[model samples]
Structure formats: structure tokens, C-alpha cells
Target chain A: MTTSVSPVRGSRDASARSGLLASRRFVSVLGWSCLVSMALLVWLGLSVAPTDAVQKDAQRLMYVHVPAAWLAYLAFGVTAACSALYLWPRTRSLHYDRLAGASAEIGVLFTALTLALGSIWGRPVWGTWWTWDARLVTTAILFFLYLGYLALRRVPDDPQVRARRSAIAALVAVVDVPIVHFSVSWWRTLHQEGTVFGEDRDAQLDATMAWILLWAVVTFTLVYLFLVLRRYDLAGIEEAADERQLERAIVERRSEAASSVVAAPEPVSVAVGAAPGSAP
Target chain B: MTDAAYVIGGWGLTAGAIGVYALLLQRRLRRAVRSLPPEERPPWA
Candidate 1:
């Protein structure tokens, strides 16, 4: 029995193509906005903002370091949410799994940057490059948790198995986030207490610095989204390739089986022809 | 060098490191996408 399945697959491909086209404009707009915002942030932070009286030029690290840490937390939160969605069978979606993977990767990068930059800032003020203070230690733990999450995804052979396990890891890692945040409050630490604007300003920051920070946050967020979307798209392509590979293998096996069946009848035909031919 | 210079250098190096890392990631993503077979090209691509 010949079962035709090609049309269904073709239609699925067509739908995916149309969906991509529909989202293209949105992605481009967000990407450009991110680029523009990053430029503005660099200009304002490096040029327009005044040098600090206390930390002096080292204060400049705030522009990058603070934002990097914030983005790391944001990315991890998204990872946890996506992982949860993936774990629940009713809400399970490859999109969510791909998003969790992308977020974990990006979050790890930012977390590392936060530590590096924090150390740079700390060296000048704290008279040392490294410390095992509460905030610092908790941040390190948070970073490793996500690193483990990324590694877990790489270990499993089956996609569904990877997704489920990674999702659980993502969820468990989220507990570290709140710990990282409250570490300064909970314990005496070398890291300064959280500030509203400038190292504990309850009111507002200088208008220019505030603007720069706002733009920086916006730009980084857009950049994060772009990265995640690109990564997710790559995952989808990989899945399609895997499916195609399987289909090709099946087709090849079936063709081989048919050839064997055809060959079996060929010997009988040869015997009949030989018997019927007197010359033979 | 003055203290101001040291501070600037530190922040500058930090920024440079992060920027380079970002570029590396973008490159990796591009390579990954390019390595895919034509039939497996992402719908977005």
C-alpha cells in the first residue's frame, strides 16, 4: 500500500515560511532600534557624563557593569519561565525550549562580564581584585548554575529528554537569583549597598546619566531579544534537518528491501528460461 | 600614569572585552547557520 505523506510536509513548510516572513519586519525594527540605542548610550556614558569625584574614572565601569548584571538577571528569569513552559506537556513547545537555551547562553555571558567588570571596579576601591564577600559569592553561584544548565542541554541525546532536563535545571537555578539579590542586605560584604541613582540616591540621578542608563538598558534588551530569536531560528532549522535525515534513511531502507524482493524473482525467471531453451 | 588614567584603562578594557565577546557570539551564530544544509535553511533565512 502506497501512502502519500509529502503534501502534508510541504504544507507545513509553506506555513513556516509565511510565519517567518510575517515576523521579519518586527525583527528588523527591533534590531535597528537596539543598534541606535547602543550608539547613544556609548556617546552619553563615555563623553557626555561628567567624571565622578569619588571613584573617579572607575565610575565609568558602572555604565557597563551595572547594566550587564541587570541583563543577566532578566535573561535568567526568561530562561526559567521558558523552561517551565517546556516541562509542562500541555504547554510544551519547541519554541520555548529553544528560547530557554538561548537565554541561558546569553545569561552566562552577561554574568561572566558582570564578575569581570565588578572586579575591575573593586580593585581600585577595595584595594583588591578579588573577594569572597556575600554578594560576590552569590553572583558566582548564580553564574555557575546557568552554566550547568547549558551543559545539561548538551548531554542528552534525545531532544525531548534534553528539553525536559534542561527545564528542570533552569527552574532550580532561579532560587539563586533572589539569593544573589539579597546577599548584600543579608550579610556584611565588600560590595556597596544598592543605590537608587548614585550609590544610594533615593531621589534621582543627574538627568544625563539617567538618560544614558535608560538607553543602555533598552538597547541591551533589544540585543538580547535579537540574539534569542536568531538562536531559536537556528534550532528550528536543525530540527528540520534531523527530520529530513530520518526520512531519507527510511526511504533508502525501503528501496533496498524492494530491490531484494525483485532480485529473488530474477533467479526463478533465469531457471525457467534455461529449461525452455533447447540450445541452452 | 595618574589614578584617572588607571581607572579609564580599567573601564576601557572591560568594555573592550565585553564587546569582543559579543562579536564572537555573533560570529558563532553565523557560522552555525551557514553550516546548515540548503534544504534545512531556517525559514527566517
Candidate 2:
């Protein structure tokens, strides 16, 4: 008889018995909606939006770059909030720990996108592939900080110890987000002030461009929503599986000890029961 | 690179990054569901 360890849905909650990602229909609906929104986003950004007065076609990069940056910030924000919740005595739960880990991983993905798109845009406008500008430097730091957070999560430790350490690390790393956002204004840099939120209207995008940019932001935000949901669901399942495996190992070890104490020689192959093995 | 090239590359890479990440999530979700015990497995999964 083969027993497979499936991912965790809290058996504790009867209402949630179907599991966290049980809504396949909901995911399908969301997936279709995301496809339509993305098609519209590309159309508006690539076909309808007017060429910039200065940067010309290169300005189109703004559509994707800004949204990616928005998601990076949003992802990290969720991680920090969830980490805080996990650490709080009143709201402590492994669910929040899993959520924080998932969000951080997604955040790292978007941060890399933000940086890469920024570099691609910079090459044509700034005549360079890279720059040590304050915003760029700070964003780079933000990337590595979360990367570190992800690494910390992988370290072998007791669940409580790992979660506590990761929570503190996540909170500390989030301090860099504000610094990255404000870096353009606070220091002399090649990067210009934000187009959407700039104080100078003259420096901002026109009505048509603004509308398209708004749509782009909405589309990407929806994309972020879709990705985070799936990622968080996976995290929940993975943690549940890990907990089950740990429990199994403990049981096996106890059984082995009991048999040994009785001077009963167990089959050597039976001792392999606690070893980590893949599911069939 | 031409301005048009930059635009195409920017959007392409952004889309690629997002698409790859979504695919990776789906793959992991599948594996996780498989690892679960029959009794604990989500019906939808």
C-alpha cells in the first residue's frame, strides 16, 4: 500500500475542508479575465498611446516598467503585513508565514522585472546599459534584501524559530521600499521623477497617454492578483505537506525506539520509513 | 537599439517574466497536490 502526502488544507476548519485552492472554477474565471485584460493592455500601450514628445517610442517602456515596480512594492507590502501578523501573539499562525514566503518570492520576481525593464529603457534614453543612480542602486538593494529573505526561509530551523527570524528580516528589508521610491527626488540622478505622480503637470503624460497608463496599471495589478493567489495557495499546500512529513518521521522514530527497547530486531528496510521520498 | 525595438523588447520581456512565473506556480501546485494524501487532497486539485 502506498500513501501519498498531499498538500495542506486546514482540517481544523470545516468550512475550508475543500482546501485553500479548491475553487478551480474561480481560477478559470480569473484566468480568462486576466487574458482579456492583458490583450487590452497591450493594445492600448502599443497601438493607441501617443509617442512621447521627448523619448518617442521608447516611452512605451513606461507602461510595463511602472506597473512592474508597482507590483514589486505591493508584493513586499503584503509580505511585510503578513509577516507582522504571523509574529503577533494574538494572530500567530503558520498560514501567515506561508503567505509571507509566497509574497516575497513573487515580489522578487517583479523586482527583477522592474530592474530589467528600467535597464532596457535606460539604454536608449540615457545611452547606457547601467547606471549607479540612487533609484537604481536602491532598487537593486531592495531586490537583494528580499532575495535574502527567501534564502532565510530555506534555512533548516524549528518552525517558530524560522518564522520569527524571517519575520524580523522581512520587516527590516521593507524599509528599503520607501527609500527606493523616494531616491529619484532625494538625490541627483539620471532617472527622472515619476510621470503619473509628478508634481509638475507639464512633466506628466497627456490625457490619452494617462488613460492607457492607467489601464496598464490596472491590468498589471490584476496580473499580480492572479499570480499571488496561486503562489500563496501553493505555499499553503507545501507547508502542510512538510508538517505531515515531519509528523510521520516523528512517529516512525518513536516506533523504532520502542521496538529497539524491546530487543526486537526490526528489518533494516523498515528503518528507512522516515526517509524523505517522492510521492508516486 | 531602435526605439521600436526597445518597446517590443520591454513588453515582451515583461510578458515573458509574468508568464514564466505563472507557469512555474501552476507546476508547483500540481506537484503539491500529488504529494498530498488521498483523504487530504483538494477535490478540485
lDDT of 1 by residue, A1-280 (tens): 1111121222224224212212556766866776677777777777888877777777766787778888899999999998887777677765677778878888898898888888878877788878889999899999888888888888846666777888888999999998888787788888877744434557446666666777777777777776666555555555555556666798999999999998898888787876654774
TM-score of 1: 0.79
Off by over 4 Å in 2: A1-22, A200-203, A264-280
Model 2: per-residue Cα lDDT over A186-270, one tens digit each: 9988999887767554645689988887888888888877787787677767766877787789899999998787775456446
Return the lDDT, model 2, position B27. Answer: 95
Cα miss at B16, model 1 (Å)?
A: 4.6
- The two-chain DockQ for each candidate, comma-separated, is 0.32, 0.71
Candidate 1: deviation at residue A169, Å? 0.8
